[model samples]
Target chain A: MTARIYITPKPDILDPQGKAVASALHDLGYQEVSEVRIGRFVTMELKGSGSPENRQRIEEMCRRLLANINVETFKIEISET
Target chain B: MTARIYITPKPDILDPQGKAVASALHDLGYQEVSEVRIGRFVTMELKGSGSPENRQRIEEMCRRLLANINVETFKIEISET
Candidate 1:
């Protein structure tokens, strides 16, 4: 099994890196682009079959290490590979 | 329209950050986790409809600014909002 997590800045939070990219895009003639937000994509491979409790365990991992609960939000996807 | 891009290191590349995270997770009791990869998630807003050409344009952006073609691979999703 695999765990795929996305950690993104909250909508109300300011993202300097995203802003920098947006500005760079604008300077490069991509004027149509705006409001960019930069985030993290994490993939973790698990050793066994999925258990119902794994979801909660993964959430705990997110809270403890994967995401900063104050400013970032996370989503997870589990898959068999 | 919104474009969500996921940028990841190539499979053959070594990801020290991901290895660090994996080690931390193991220390924290997520022993089931093995291979791990860390990536970037970038969201950009576009001004108009999604045209066929926009995909090409976005790919160009990825090649030039969003991702390092030599070591990174990117996936893009364009959505209407």
Candidate 2:
């Protein structure tokens, strides 16, 4: 089983890195790019099959460590490979 | 237009951060988690509709600044909202 977690800054938070990237894009002639938000993408492989318990455990992991609850939001996607 | 860029470490590269994350998961009782790889997720808002030329420009941005070609690979997804 594989799980992917996508974490992004809260919408109301200021993202300096994203701002820099947006500026760089404009300088690179990608003037169409008006805003940019940078985040984290995490992929993990599990040893066994996927189950509700595993999902819950992964969610706990996200809450405890993978994301900063106050400033970031996360989404999870799971698949069997 | 919104464009999402997912950047990941090259397969052959060593990722200490990922290792630490995997180890942490194990210590946290997520023994099923066997491996973990950490990467970047970037979302950008563009001023116009998605088009071939804009796509090309975004690709160029990825190649030149968004990703470290030698150590990372990036995938882009575009949409109009």
Candidate 3:
């Protein structure tokens, strides 16, 4: 199974890196790029079948390690193909 | 309409940020977090309705503004519901 995780800053959190990127975009003549927030996409190949237990374990991992409970949020997508 | 775009460094590209994150994860006692690369997941609520032309435009925008053609690659998923 493969798990793709996306971790991002919470809406109310301040994102300095994202702001810097946005400013760079503006300087690059991308005026339409109004809102920009930098996030993370982590892709992993898990060594297990797609069982309910495995899903639960992956969720637990997300809560514990893959995401920071404060300031950042995460979403996970799993694929069995 | 909404679009979720994932931008990431290519496999051969060097990712200093990802290395730093991996080290942090290791220090956090996540031994299983061996491979960690930081990427971007951009969620955008587009104004117009869903159309092929709209998708093309959005893709063009991604190529031009949302992603760097040299070291980063991007994939966009659109949701209308």
Candidate 4:
């Protein structure tokens, strides 16, 4: 099975990197683009039968290792393909 | 409309941050994890209808602003909500 995890800055937190990217976009003439928040995209391949138990394990993986729960949040998408 | 852009290091690139995270995970007792690669996740709430043209524009945004085409690659997923 494969899983994709998205790790992003907390909504209330300030993101300097995102701010920098937003400014760069403004300078580059992409005026329609208003805001940008930068975060993490993690893809992992796991060897396991795709089951509810495995899904639970993957979520645990995100909470413990893939994301810093203090400053960032994470969402997981899993696929057997 | 909303769009999610996932930006990740090129497969061939060396990711020190990912290495650090992997080591940290090992320390935390997640021995099942063999490798880690850190990347970026961007979620943008976009205005206007979600159309093919709009999607193209969003992808251009990724290529020009959200990602560094040299070292990073991006995939955009758009949804009307």
Q: Which structure is stronger by lDDT: 1 or 2?
A: 1
TM-score of 1: 0.97
Question: Which interface RMSD values do the candidates have, in the order shown?
Answer: 0.8, 0.8, 3.0, 1.9
Poorly placed runs, candidate 4 (over 4 Å): none
lDDT of each: 0.91, 0.91, 0.74, 0.80
Candidate 3 lDDT over residue span B1-81, tens digit each: 767789888889988887876676567664554566667887665566668977876687678777897999998888884
Assess each model's interface with DockQ, reporting 2 decimals per model.
Answer: 0.89, 0.89, 0.41, 0.56
lDDT of 1 by residue, B30-73 (tens): 99889889999998898887788988888898999999989999
Candidate 1 lDDT (Cα, 0 to 1): 0.91
Alpha carbon lDDT at A40, candidate 2 = 99
- After aligning candidate 1 to the native by TM-score, how far in Å is the CA of A17 from where it should be? 0.3
Q: How well is each residue in B1-81 modelled by candidate 4, as lDDT tens digits?
A: 878888889999998998887787778766655677788888777677788888888888888767789999888887888
* Tens digits of lDDT, candidate 1, A33-74: 868999999988898866788878889999999999999999
Q: What is the model-wide C-alpha lDDT for candidate 2?
A: 0.91
For candidate 4, state the interface root-mean-square deviation in angstroms to 1 decimal: 1.9
TM-score of chain B of 2: 0.95
> DockQ score of candidate 3?
0.41
Worst 10 residues of 3 chain A by lDDT: A28-37
Per-residue error for A39 in candidate 4, Å, reads 1.5
lDDT of residue A81 for candidate 4: 66
- RMSD of model 3, in Å? 3.6
Q: Candidate 3 residues A8-58, lDDT tens each?
A: 889999888878766765786645445667777887655676688777766
In model 3, residue pairs whose N, Cα or C atoms come closer than 3 Å (at least 3 residues apart or on different chains), thus clashing, are none
Order of models, best DockQ first? 2, 1, 4, 3
Task: Compute fnat per model.
Answer: 0.89, 0.94, 0.43, 0.49
